[model samples]
Target: MALTVELDIRNPSGLHARPAAVFVKAAAGFGSDIRVANLSTESPEVTAKSIIAVLGLGVQRGHRIRLRAEGADEADAMAALEGLVAAGLEEPLDEAPPAAPVA
Candidate 1:
């Protein structure tokens, strides 16, 4: 059976090129077949292992994305992906807030 999850994106820039690559990388580590869809934008589901397909979803911050995985390692794949989302895609450093100027 395929494991499906809908999660909100927390990355400040959404799943832009770099983070999308990370996502694809993670998905590729599993033997399961994974796919994703941008629920907020109603984007079509595409193979999660491909950076091009993942980026085509146009996922943005706060957008809801649906992930599905099927195969022997589907459970592990879903758990790994869920962890990544919870970590804000490893928390991109560029999104750090600017420091206050010294008075």
Candidate 2:
């Protein structure tokens, strides 16, 4: 399955080193292949998966980002990623307890 998540950049600092690192780390936790993109801008080279790629986006607060994950675990990856953005991209996905643990 392939899933796509539209993320609203809420971090005051945008996707800076810290948030980008956090996002990258979050992406790394999943068993699927994940990628992030800044859909609202003209740049197409800034992929959200790579630290350099995400940083290249230069996305600011209020920018809309598109996150895509593909693999057997794509659904879970997207869910966790949506949670990460909803949380302001501050806390790591694993750090937040799930509403209902996966069986």
Candidate 3:
């Protein structure tokens, strides 16, 4: 079964741009398959390793997101991600949200 977690994003700017990038980077380091869904917006679940997908969730401050990971390192991935959120996902409010993904 997949390990799942629901986190209330406390960042003032939410999961956009840099925070999203940081999250994607961290998620990509794991061998597990990780999926994230924005519960508040009812966005479809998407892979945690994609910056664009995470950004598309329209996550904002106080929004709740659910994470699911299933694989050999699912536990570690969740713990590390939990730590990342606890660490404020980098700057809490110093970032400006991106208007669009820079492709």
Candidate 4:
């Protein structure tokens, strides 16, 4: 069975560089075969485990992407991915400034 969900990109910088890498890593953790298609860009669906493919979709902030996972773990994979997307792909910025160097 395949589980599908539409996720909105919330990262300010979108799925580029680190964000793409993070997404690819998460997708790889599951046993399911995961694929993603960019709804906003109308790009072809690609395997979620491939960083190159995910980046190739040209997903940007506010863009909605469809995620489909097929396998025994499809539901769990979809849930995890959905949470990740909702939380935004980027790590929260550290608010504290660097300490001054010792003289």
For each candidate, what is the lDDT? 0.90, 0.77, 0.90, 0.87
Better of 1 and 2 by TM-score: 1
Query: Residue 6 CA error for candidate 1 (Å)?
Result: 0.4
Clashes of each: 0, 1, 0, 0
Query: What TM-scores do the predictions have?
Result: 0.87, 0.78, 0.87, 0.85
lDDT of 2 by residue, 1-103 (tens): 6777777777766788998898888878878888777877856634446798888888887788888888888898888878878887883334332357669
Q: When superposed on Cα atoms, how far off is each prediction in RMSD? A: 4.2, 10.6, 6.2, 7.0
lDDT of 4 by residue, 1-103 (tens): 7988998777766788898898899999999999999999888889999999998999977789999999999999999888888777656533354458999
Residue 74 in candidate 3 has what lDDT?
Answer: 98
Candidate 3 weakest ten by summed lDDT: 91-100
Query: What is the TM-score (0 to 1) of candidate 3?
Result: 0.87
Poorest 10 consecutive residues by lDDT, candidate 4: 90-99
- Give lDDT tens digits, candidate 3, residues 1-103: 7999999888877887998999999999999999999999998899999998999999998799999999999999999998898777886553455467779
> Could you tell me the lDDT of residue 29 within candidate 3?
100
Candidate 2 lDDT (Cα, 0 to 1): 0.77
lDDT of 3 at 19: 85
lDDT: which is higher, 1 or 2? 1
Show where candidate 4 strays beyond 4 Å. 93-103
